[model samples]
Target: MSDSPAGQAAQKNAPHTITLLQHNALKGFLLAAAGLFLFACMDSTTKYLTTHYNVPFVVAMRYIVHFLLMVMILAPRHSAQLVYTQRTGLVVARAVVLTIASLCMGMALHRMPLAETTAINFLAPTLVALLAGSMLGEKIGGWGWAAIVTGFIGVLLIARPGGGLDAVGIMFALGAAAANATYQLLSRLLASTEKAIALLFYTALLGSIIFGIALPWFWENEAPSELEVILLLSMGVSGGLGHYLFTLAYRHAPASMLAPTTYLQLLWAGLLGWIIFDTIPDSMSLIGMAIVAASGLIIAFKSH
Candidate 1:
């Protein structure tokens, strides 16, 4: 029988709605890809700067610029309330842990290939999955466990004895992974009670304060050239803007849909590493990265 006018109107609008949704998803994916590229650039810039500056100085400068950008970008809406939080202690701890993670990752990058260090750091999501049940009271099924195990195997492939990767860099990358996993877990816990801008501001403020205080002791005596200065500032600009783009991406797509796009960072890291430093991961290392990425993708799809 003929449908009512309301039913006909609803049917007419459904395809247009679906098209709009698909468009938004495509935009989100592009934003995520761009953010990953910017992040890769930030890492490459930090690695380059380490040749002339101490790790602490490079890290501090990035966060110092990050802090200034946060003030300009977030303060208008949040005002002094940018520092307010429901769980103050957790927020502070999250900032501290993330700072430590950056320091460790910086140290690793200074001594290792960008692809290798970045691959090892990919263990963070696996660690989060493994620890979530105990730490966050979340449940993980057999698939999650399998993915975690596979991820560790990938780590072993990259970091096995005599793999030609530096032992110190390997240790630093491992530390960064653990620290980052903890940071991710904490961020999840706080997401319910805290504003994203407020959390972002705290991390920027804390990173700057922590690293800036230590900057004096780690200062390089030689002055940087104007070009070096630009690159150094670019670290923060890229990092800050990359993070902004990353957050913006989730608005258009769910985390599950966006999660796999993060693996694009490995590609960006490899390209940047090759272009900037003339290095690429060897055959075994590439296989290891593939394993790590597969494991992470499984978890992302399953968790979604």
Candidate 2:
């Protein structure tokens, strides 16, 4: 039987309940921002290390140490289950493309200014959004197309004649963006069927294996000193910890609440570049970066 009218009135006035897994949007936003900051740290550290070490080896250290850290900590907790995935091929493809993106980004950072390089990469999300219309049959409207054009213009300004940027570095940065877009696309494709831990495991595992195979060619006979070793290890820690923080964040908030703040990494990149390397973007370059960021923001909001 239905409850009395008084009980129904009381029930209607009851407070809305939040699940243990989700509801804290403020905490989630902060965590997402922190995760993006770690990503900026990882990029800056890579650029600094590449000044003294080989690009391939430096990139390898990141993935190798990251893979090791994951094994040491995560494996004990999750055991073999950590490596299980329903979609093997898509997962590997995502990992491979991410590895490629890392390699390309490392090479670019070794040559280009951190802020500009990161700005160029900002185009990747825009590319993914625009391409989804063609690839995934998602109709991106006129605004999406406008964002696409504006994003390229921003890149062109950053790479324009006498921008004082290296042509090869600019190309490498573009390549990284392309590879990164592909990686994101594959990640989206696999999100439904794959477990997060398994996806993370394969990415780190394959990145280490692929880069480790080429390590010999770039190996230095003179071992890095103890301090240098610490820096190398820090790269991996920042990466692993960054992802961990991101995971914690999602448990408290929705993805839509967190997506826009990813652009904060570009700002963090600029500040760190100035402080760490004494590099600053020129006026035109700064404008370009702004345009790129604006374009990405538009795409993000529209999708929401």
Candidate 3:
């Protein structure tokens, strides 16, 4: 009954190992939940801004504030190197896509109900599943295909071709979904080798530059009030912080484990929309959201 050295070491480490695993799991769940909360908050803030301000002006200001905050936070730690990157093209592409997505989401927020816009954005995950198979050569099975189709159908239910279609709003939502899919796919490609902090730093820096150039065309005649400016600033800071937490979440657990939790954002969006604007979604909208959420949850579970 004598224990070997390796067995003794394993026994000694067992409790510590179990404790570490539990800590990581709890951290991942908390990070994922926080990320969702921040995202919902960003959407709510954007909706508020768009109600009273030009979409582009709000978007530009938000990115500018985000860029400045990132510089303030990361510059002391890593100077000009924040913009230095071997993947310059990839970085630029990510920035462009993200800026465009933000613009489109802003437009959607201006015109559509918040919950509906959030639900449509969730279509990005399904698009990511398909793109991973095609662009990244991942093996997505039959269930993945089914989920993609089901999710698209839910979008159609919301858009309602001829019934409730606000062509501009629907198009904006779709564009946002596409941009989000591209962003997620690029993140997956980079995550295998790049440091998460570096990736995020570059995204904020480049996004600021790209959006900065575009800001002149959309600048408003009147400056935003103090309260509007504060919300815009909060949006950028929260968005950047959320991205950081999400990166931490992935380090602790598989994406599949945390993916389904994103549906919680729809609920948050719905509640925010109701309270802030007294915007209650109709029965059809609720049903459409349910379909989208259920299909997305199934997709996340099946892919896992």
Candidate 4:
């Protein structure tokens, strides 16, 4: 009745292996949660920096740090095939659009309340739905169209053209939304064949190059304080890590399951806004945020 050596080993190690796997899964979920929180911190810091510094200078510095960080992260995972890919065109297009989105969001952050800026940016999902329908010929049903229209109305409420709108902020947020929509569409097109790391690597590389050319013109007369520089560096790290964890979460779970989790970002945004700047979004802004969130959540549920 004695067991063979191999059978004994298997029995002895199986429980430990299962425990290790469970630990790893839990670790991944915790990392994703931390990433989301850091991303909110990054947004809050960007808003703070823009209040004291020039938007272009702050933005360019942010990208430069982010680009360098991405390269360092990718060098270890090096693949020569990164430069040559079937989705090269789409990658480049996505990078250009992302660059525009970043710049516009920078402007919005500088000119508007943190929560308001974040709320306006929510329009991107709705825009993505419409863009997919028009550009990719995806079939969007009646509810999708309704959601899209409601999202736009939310945008209008925030913009409130005649009512103390910061013209630059409003325009920047709109431009960011459009670019974000384009980026999402391009991501869907490339997801099947391109490695996620490769796509992210090129996007950061190309974005750095595009922003590099313009950095000189916006260079500041005085360097940022050491503490400020540290925060700026953290911003890049936070953003890059957030995207990485988000990609990982998508692999582990379905989009529908993860979609609701993203709404946590708004709560983080609001908390950070209050803690750092003592700025609370007004009643109108909160109403707009509710509308945008409702529309996006409705679309997510409907799509499911």
Candidate 5:
């Protein structure tokens, strides 16, 4: 039987239920922002380390540390299960995609400023949204096309002729974005059958194993200072922790709400770039950054 009129009225009058949801959503937003900031820190540190080390070396050290940390943190709770997966091939494929994305991003940082490389990487989400129709079987409608075009225009602005941008750097950054989009799509495909920790574990483990094979060829054997070694380790730590925060945030909020917050990483990237490398975006680049962010925000809101 339905609730009595008084009970229904009482439930309607209760504000705490609404308050709780609002509180949780707010917490999600803050957590996402914090995660993005942490990731920005990771990128800044990666860029700094690349100046003293090769991209392969930096990437290998990062995943090795990440793998060790995962074993230490997750082994107690999910030792054997860490590698358990219903879709082993997809899992390995996902890892390969992310590993390639990491390599491209590292190379981009080696050639481009942190903010610009980051700006280009921001295209990942827009691509994901546009491809969702064909890839994820979700319709994007007209607004999605507009957002895609807007994002592309923003990229053109930043990568315009004689913008002092390296051709190879721009290419690498675009490659990273495309690979990252593939990674996101694979994560979605595995979301139903795979544990989040399992995916994380494999990404780090596979990256470490694959890169370890090539480490000997690229190893410079330079004795990094104490600070450099610490910084390199911090890169992996920040990456693992940042992704953890992002996962936790989604537990409290939907992806649509969190999508817009991802753009905040660009701002964090710009600030950290200036502080660490004294690199500032030019006026035109800043405008381009604003446009890219606006396009992402539009899609996020529209998706809602």
Candidate 6:
């Protein structure tokens, strides 16, 4: 209500600032959604590639190319911020966690269908909501708990006995889910001090080094065809771009609030699995996927 020049400037800028914030929120949501789809593409491609190569090699190639792409693109833009972080130990730990996730997911994809594998992984977001309270000090209400429980039930239906999914693959998928949940929580915590690019960079760096050393063990000496070459390279682009978008999204929005948006991954995975592999989830698994997605959506949108 002040009539001063500074006061008038503040008033004029208020609406613009509010509009900017809204635009960022919208952008973040779209990015998060698209990121998940790319992730589905990455996983589907991995599932296809794993049939021809070992898990470590597939993962190493993904990260090696990912690291190179970051150097070529993100490094120039972000400069030191891409290579440095206040939380050095935490950044390394987060990268290791993601590496574990990539390895587990790769192993799972070796035998599992893309849609089922991805639906199982959607448990990560619900698990994040469940753990946010204790790990990140974020509050979760009764509805959040309900959603988490529902998500578990959905996963159960998909992995139930006589469901035709491989037991080992299911176990690996569960491991990937746990690691991914931890990675998401760590990302949310680090976003306070670390730039998304820094977190992303360290992850690719660690993945590259860790898997690169073991590359000889799982090396495919026969050489890949043109299609295989494209798929291998696409993994890096999709993974790097997907995680960057997801990181930016969580930086702008709470991890829990952004949980529902990740369900788009289920849609993409199902579509890609069908199109690329000529596979579809059975009735039971489809129902389970629906149950899990609905629960996570309910939990995320409960307080939004």
Q: Write down the RMSD of all candidates, one decimal each.
A: 8.5, 8.1, 7.5, 8.6, 8.1, 6.1
- TM-scores for every predicted model: 0.83, 0.84, 0.84, 0.80, 0.86, 0.90
* TM-score, prediction 3: 0.84
Best by TM-score: 6
lDDT by candidate, in order shown: 0.79, 0.77, 0.74, 0.68, 0.80, 0.85
Best by lDDT: 6
For candidate 1, write residues 172-269 as lDDT tens digits: 99999889778767765665455556677788889999999999999888999998989988988898777657645644654434544677888889
The runs of at least 3 residues in candidate 4 whose Cα sits more than 4 Å from the true structure, single-residue gaps closed, are 1-38, 81-84, 134-139, 247-263
What is the C-alpha lDDT profile of model 5 across 146-189, one tens digit per residue?
87799888878888888998999999999999997787667655
TM-score of 5: 0.86
Query: What range of 10 consecutive residues in model 1 has the weakest lDDT sum?
Result: 14-23
Q: Over 4 Å off in model 3, which ranges?
A: 1-29, 137-139, 162-165, 250-260
Candidate 2's C-alpha runs over 4 A off are: 1-32, 134-139, 243-261
Candidate 6, residues 50-126, lDDT tens digits: the string is 99989899999999999999999877776766875666898999999999999999999997999998888878988
Off by over 4 Å in 5: 1-31, 247-260
Task: Tell me the number of clashing residue pairs for each predicted model.
Answer: 0, 0, 0, 0, 0, 0
lDDT of 6: 0.85
The per-residue C-alpha lDDT of model 4 at residue 130 equals 68
Candidate 3, residue 233: the lDDT equals 90
Better of 2 and 4 by TM-score: 2
Displacement of residue 155 (Cα, Å) in model 4 is 2.0
Ranking by lDDT: 6, 5, 1, 2, 3, 4
lDDT for position 14 in model 5: 56
TM-score of 4: 0.80
